[model samples]
Every structure is written in structure tokens, then in C-alpha cells.
Target: MAVTKTPIEDVAGDFHRPAEHDGVALWWLGQAGFLLRHNDLRLAVDPYLSDSLAEKYRGTPFPHRRIMAAPVAAGALTELDFVFCTHSHTDHMDPGTLPDMARASPRCRFVVPAAERMKAMERGVPPDRLILVAAGDVVVLSGNFSAAVVPAAHEERWQDGEGHDFFLGYKFRAGEKAVYHSGDCVPFDDLGDWLGVDSIDVALLPVNGRDARRKANGIPGNFHLLEAIALCRNAAIPLLLGHHFGMFDFNTIEVEAARSEIRSLGASSYAELIQPMTRYDIR
Candidate 1:
């Protein structure tokens, strides 16, 4: 799917909008990134706005080519309560973008897996503002709001070791409502058990099907279309949103394919595709 760039109207304006709903307001920023706002708290996950990867690896075997322009600039962000990085992948943990965002929001805390501590530090993020989390770790943002880090099978668990926490998903809770952002993951048998199948209100997952073609090109992929539906059933997720597509010109699956697959599964009512820059009021 070709990317559709959403113009950044005004960074401050976007963040300071009047509340129209009571639950979580989520804005899809393309790729695996999202800007979530609930009351006074503001958070973002896996934002890759800069075209650094595209420029840096222009001639490399795995170049980061973007399908469209970024919706918002990193410098435009402010008053960020927290930022979450699920892993160290360039697209997810952008080196060029994170530093600028960190500098812009000096007091904002960055929540990442333990493996990203050093990387974050090297990017000049303040140690005091960095919160290293692991699987099963929970960080309470306020009295009724919290975020939980859960293990994700990206290729395999860590692929290195346990102490070095690598891939992860985040379950954001606001009172009783919960949203699970599965950062670039494939399904595992224990996923349902770990997520408490009946507790998930919204589940955001990657739908670029993993296959020999993608692997042969040296690009690791995520869950396929049909697999995504099955995963949603297994997890008992009430609402499922498809992502991890429409960002890259290469190494991505068409959005129509995902939409068609969901419809074919007769899961269209429960699962849907998220377009960039669109906000959904998850209740």
C-alpha cells in the first residue's frame, strides 16, 4: 500500500486539542507508531519520522525506503509524558529521530526494553528519564493509568538471551480499558495466556505476511493476513487493528490484501485496518 502523508498542522496545536471523548484517543503515525492521549497523559510508540534510514542505506542490501512523507516532524513534538520503543530495529528505534525527540521533550520519560538502555544513552537521552523494562514489568503512569511490557516473538524470543531483553509488546491500561500494541511480532502459543485473552479491548498487530520471499530478500516480516485473524480469535481481542504496513515502499504488504483477508475471514466487524493520521476513540 502506498503511504499517505498526513501534514503536521501544528505540533503544539495537535497536542493541545480539546478532549472530545473520555477513553483513549489514538492517532496512527504510520509503521508501528501511534500517538495516544488519555486525559493528561500523552504517549507515543515506535515513531519513525525521519528519512535517515532511506538516506543512510541507499545502496545497501536492506535500504529503508519510505512509501510517503512523515506525518509529523520529531522536532514538532512536545509535552510528551512518555515514549515507548519496543525494540532496536531501525524503523522502530530510529537513531536520527529519537535523539531529536528526546531533546525536544527534556523531561519526558522514555520506556524501552532493557536491551535499549545503552542505545538510548548513546543517543544522549538522560539516564534519569530512561525507564528500562522487561517482560511482565509494569510502570504505573498515574493512579489509574499504567503500561505493561509483554514478551513478543519477533523471529524468536530475543534470539540472543533472556537477560538481554529485546522484542516486546506494550499493554496500555487506562482504568479498565486496555490497548495492546504488538510491536512487530509473530504469534506464539503462549501469547493468549500471557495477554489474558478476555482482557484485551484493542489489539494492534503487524500484517505483512512472513514468507520465503521476504526472508530471501533479507527482510524479516510479521504475521500473515489469515494468521492475524486467528491470532485475534486466540487472544479473544474485541477489536483488532492492522498496522506495520503502508510505511515502506519495499518490504511491505498491500493494505487491500489485509483488508480483503479480514473480510474473507468474516472478521471485518471485529478487525480493521488503520490508516495513517486517523484517530480512533477506543472505548
Candidate 2:
């Protein structure tokens, strides 16, 4: 089946400049993409270019349209050391962006969920550079930095028999600071036990909050705004980085309302939700 392109607005190209860093900082690169920096170490996670989903979903009414362009381009952000992919989800395992990233930053190694190793390998990501890891597996990326792979309840969370796909979330720690990217998941019965840790400084979640509710194809299966709030509040995180919000015009909740709900969650004193086109300095 021909993949539907995200609307024109969604693919508009406008690259933002990289920020100068001192300790650690995170930049939203549009959709589920991010560029994180800490001194000499740089990590790109689910880095999707602006136009990847544009032409295909242009005329589709249901799927959300892209809003602002990706914060930066693949070629623009180079010298990567680590590329973390949560799963085979297109948002994370983009075909268009991955190859260019590989070409642009040959030194970077890919850390992905162990279960999806073969799928990423099939996508020409190279067999040797792929590091397959799961929960309890700690990968010492480089100089005092490490990451722990955690299982996520993907859209197909309860699939039985032989037909199912697994999603991966990552908890990364460098010194005393840590961040958790939940990937695409819904709240589980023992969701608290999932994190295993009590707190995360910066929690990136899906304010668009998707579960198995939507029946349409190509729908963004991310966390709902409320659910994301609950996750962070329960986990007692101080900051929430909102993604999957403005990717498309129709499907996404307006940025203002999304922010309001997050702020109103009574977690604001401890938790903060930031908009796209914004950056936060992690100290």
C-alpha cells in the first residue's frame, strides 16, 4: 500500500540553528525527533526530516497534517556518537532519515530494542553498528554515559499468538542527570513498576496520547495529554517535554490548550511542559 503523505504544512522546511551548550540541553527537532547535547557527546533520537511524511498524507482528511518544519536537517546535525531508536515505528525508524544520518555521521552507533534488531538491520542500518538491548541491559555508551532499554506497550500491546510487534523506551543517564523517553505506550496496570526509577529530570512524552482507540490507519499512536500528565506526575518528574503535538494541523490538539492542561494538572510546581520550537537547558 502506498503510504499517505502528511499534509503540506507538516513538511514545510525550516531548520533551526543548533544551540551552544555548557552542560546538557535538549532541542525538539519536530514530531518525535530530538537532538540532545552534553559537552562532547551528542545523541539524536528518532530524528525525522520535515518532508518524510508530507507528500503521502497531503489529501488525507483523518491523519494530522505537519505544522512547522523539522527543527534541523540530517546533514545539518552531524558528528553523532549515538542514535537511539525506541522501535520500528516509522516515527523512530524512518527510512528516509536513517540512511542520510548513517552517511552523515559514520561514527555514530545505533542502540535499538533487541527485538527489532532484525527489522532495523533489514533497513540497511548495518549489522555491526547495531546494539540490541532490553530492560536490565545497561549499555555504557561512552565516558561515564549509559542507557537502559525498557519495554513499552506499543499500539499492539496485547497481541497474542505469532502476530505482534514490540516497542522500546529508553532511560538514559549521564552522571547524576537522567531522562526517559516513553516511546509510544499506554498506561499499564503496573506502570510505576515500569519506570523502575523514582524520578526523571526531563520526561519526553506524547501529549497526543494515542492508544488502541483510533481505528483509522496511519493514526499517531501516542499518549493522550492527560495520560502523559499522569505518567509524569506519578513518576514525580519536574519537567515534561511535549512531542507529537503539532506534527499535523487536524489531528493534534492546539498547542495552547495542550499546555494549559499540562499546567493545570497540579504538577506544574514540580513539572513543566514545553512547547515545540523551544529548548531547555538541563543542569
Candidate 3:
């Protein structure tokens, strides 16, 4: 029954917009967490932030200590709309951060997987605000804000009895743009078919420490190195944002290999692989 959290070192929640940046603004809060803000819509994905994460997973944590601090605190997020949790994992759906976030942004909704509803309820995310989506289920956010649930392959982990069968991936649409974020999984055969619909504008993928041989559930990773590139290539996304790296264990492939591979992809522009407390805009 252990939950995860991240430390909020810097509390000032000001984000600077680049002079040349266009359309919606993207703020990265390290690991698999990010904020995509457009007009009144604020979308947050994965929050492995606050001292709660650190305190939850001290020694022999799933991975290890993350190298960065959360860009802002859960209570500090002023304008938040919908919050999405790909699964019930601590890094993706943290116990510490969620409650504070619920308290802070009373207006934001938690769009989560069906399997994770009980966990979110345990964390105090209200019943009414919990929007559940199973694999293949779609939730439209106005004409612009929209999303579809896809299968997140945790094959090795599931086979080894480490992962739950209901873990999910998300395909989100914000106006003319489409983005995909995979919570945690090793690559699966059906990925292309799941993410093939509509021209994907951006893809936020995990290039982190997925090889969990001796760790908690042994759920490894979804897109390790080559598979991550294959996802962007198949999805036909203009930009691929590499996440879930550098936040934990400096010795893992997530910290070492992800950026180099992201830079080497065959897209018009390489995905903006970010470090902690940085923002990348989607035009």
C-alpha cells in the first residue's frame, strides 16, 4: 500500500513564454509529468512530484532518487482543468500529490483508467469528478479537448505478475493537435493500430528506466530505445517529447540513452527531450 511523491524545491510558479513559441504552451515538471495550457484549458499528465514521492519511496524505491525538483507544488497550480492518470502507478498517479491537487484545483477533473478509480478514491479524488475510461473508450473535451484510451502493453510485467491487466495509454486531441502519453509499459504489437488514427501532433513517451528485473512489479517499460522511435515514426507525429527520464537513477538508460536517441529520430524535428523545470511549446 505504498504511494509515490516528488519534492517541490522551487515554489515560484511562473513560466516564461519564448518569444518565438506558438499556439499552446507546454510546461514540463520532470519525469512523466507535464502541463499543456491553452486558453482556459489546463491539462496535466503524471505528477511524480512533491516530498510525498521522496518520502514514500526512500531506499530501494522502484527506481531511485530523481535528479530534479517539481516545477511547482500541487497546491500552487492555479489554473487546472482536466487531470489524466494513465494508470495507478505511483509515479503516474501519486498518492501524495493527488490529494493536494484535488484540494488546490477544485475545478479540475481526474480522467483516469477504470481500474484506478478505487485508488484515486482512496487518495480522496471525489467520486463525481472521477471520469473513467477503459481501453478503446473515448472522451471528448469540447470540440478541442478530447481523448481516447488505448492499450498500454505491460506484457513482460503482466506475465511475471508485476503489472495489472487494466493499465492504459491515452491519445489526446487539443483542437488541431493530437498527442499521446504512455504511462508505463514495454512496447506492444498493437501500438501502431491504437495510435494510428488522426495525424498525431505530439507524442510524450517514456524513455526511462523500464528494466525492472528485481523491482516492484517487474513492469519494465513500454518504449525502451528503438521502440520509442518506432512509435513516433508510426504515429506520424511532428514532435515527440521524451519524458520519464533523468528524474530517477542517473545510471539507467532513461537518463543516459533517451536524449541521444530522441535527437536521432527521423522526424522533421527531434522531440524536445526535457530536463527538470523546463517548458516546451506545441504550435
Best by TM-score: 1
Kindly provide the TM-score of model 1 when superposed on the true structure, using C-alpha atoms. 0.91
Worst 10 residues of 3 by lDDT: 1-10
Tens digit of lDDT per residue, candidate 1, span 77-191?
A: 8778898989888788888778888888877898988977887777656788899998889999878889988888876667345575588999999877888998888988787
lDDT of 3 by residue, 69-137 (tens): 666778777566788887776777888788888888898899887766688888768898999877778
| Model 3 ranges off by over 4 Å | 1-22, 59-63, 155-165, 212-219, 254-268
Ten-residue stretch with the least lDDT total in model 1: 1-10
What number of clashing residue pairs does each candidate have, in the order they appear? 0, 13, 14
List ranges where model 2 is wrong by over 4 Å.
1-22, 56-65, 156-165, 211-213, 218-220
Q: Give the winner by TM-score: 1 or 2.
A: 1
Instruction: Sort every candidate by TM-score, greatest first.
Output: 1, 2, 3
| Clashing pairs in model 1, backbone N/Cα/C closer than 3 A | none
lDDT of 2 by residue, 1-283 (tens): 0111112221112112343433456667766677776666778887777465565556666443456666556766567888888778666787768777788788888887766777888755878888877656778876766777666775545432433336767777767777788777767776578687645777888666663445365564767777777777788776666676666665466777765765676655544444555455666
lDDT of model number 1: 0.79
- For all predicted structures, in order, the TM-scores are 0.91, 0.82, 0.81
**How many pairs in model 2 have backbone atoms within 3 A of each other, for residues 3 or more apart or on separate chains, i.e. clashes?**
13
Q: What is each predicted model's overall lDDT from 0 to 1? A: 0.79, 0.66, 0.66
